[model samples]
Target: MRVLVVEDETSLAEVVRRGLTREGFVVDVMHDGQDGLWAATESAYDVIVLDIMLPGLDGYQVIARLREAGVWTPVLMLTAVDGEHDQAEAFNLGADDYLTKPFSFVVLVARLRALIRRGAPERPVVLTNGSLSLDPVRRRVLRHGSEIALTPKEFALLTFLMMHAGEVVTKATILDAVWDPAYDGDVNIVEVYVGYLRRKIDTPFAEASIETVRGVGYRLLEAGPAGPAGPAGPAEPAEPAEPA
Candidate 1:
């Protein structure tokens, strides 16, 4: 497989190149962000190993530009800084995988192979269900062309639901995804947040985009519910029915 390694550290870059070459991969190395971005955009690569700290544009900008240019090559971001926010930013910018500094060469190879196996598929910058749209990078939600304010928890719940649009996600699953998996609080919190989302994203627009699945869970409709535009009236009961 052909791979591009974009790292400012010349010594490390050569080491990675030699190791990968030994692993039967055809490797190309770029020492700075500008050169890396140009190589990535101008050539077809099975995958890319990019460093976050670069002299010219930086890793984040490189990945963002690569994606904007419609290059869907899977990218495995390498960075010395390890933080959740940094990881989230990389993912938002279309990075396929991430590895922090001091990582094992074995892990790197395995992750690269896994990414290559997955291949590159275009990922939408904005997620939408009907008139409702969610921009993960900007942390914005809009309904019917107007922006809607949402609390952090409410936003997380909405994001989870929208990501699984048209699927019934159970309370347990939602809790694990949106809330702390170690959370011991009442599971009904999911119902409350779902209600909150409906009020902001659906009720105001006279839409029923989120559907209760009775004993199952909830499904976000792919298209807005058909009806005349008007007040949505009362919010749905926040209590979910017991599974039958």
Candidate 2:
């Protein structure tokens, strides 16, 4: 899963980043409210942590604008002010949860997990495609009742693919969601990780779940045996005329 932390306090932001990274979440940080708002709008994140006092925009305006623009990614408002009206304002502006400063990091993690679970569409606890299962909270993947070990990056990539199972996802989409916004590396890095995943998740099982789409991208097969089931591949040519 991915998280966006929009806090101006450098020390606090760094602390949060280290803690969440240890917990196996791909995290992005923004110092100003405008940057945070823009990042939240442009990218797909599982959850966001926004601090109230900011340089460009306040947390209230940020959350309000997100709601106005229909960006429903869960937002957890952070502020030093603990006034009842302030909390009320955040909720009214569509903040999913609120955390006051001097808060417990342990409690914050728990709250973020709760928000993710509540925001998930159907199966919030685990994401499954066929017999393959992934527990986002536990950061574990299981296939055919066997546990599959994956590096953090590999796990994040697979989780994103599994989240959108059966959909043909483009390389750009994968880069945006799986990697940080500041990543200046080649996009082919996606292919590298995909290859790593295929070796572990598909090669052993003899399952072509993650399939290359030729000129397009890749898809994770859903609910059935994997096959050449996506858009038709290059068509065969007609036979030459035999007339004299």
Clashes (N, CA, C under 3 Å) per candidate: 0, 0
Off by over 4 Å in 2: 1-48, 51-75, 78-95, 98-123, 224-244
Give all TM-scores, in the order shown.
0.52, 0.53
Q: What is each predicted model's overall lDDT from 0 to 1?
A: 0.81, 0.79
Q: Scored by Cα lDDT, where does model 1 land?
A: 0.81
- Pairs of residues clashing in candidate 1: none
Pairs of colliding residues, candidate 2? none
Q: Which ten residues in a row have the lowest lDDT in candidate 1?
A: 225-234
lDDT of 1 by residue, 95-211 (tens): 999999988999999999999999887455687776778776566898778999987677767777777787888988787556643369998888877877777787687677777
TM accuracy, model 2: 0.53
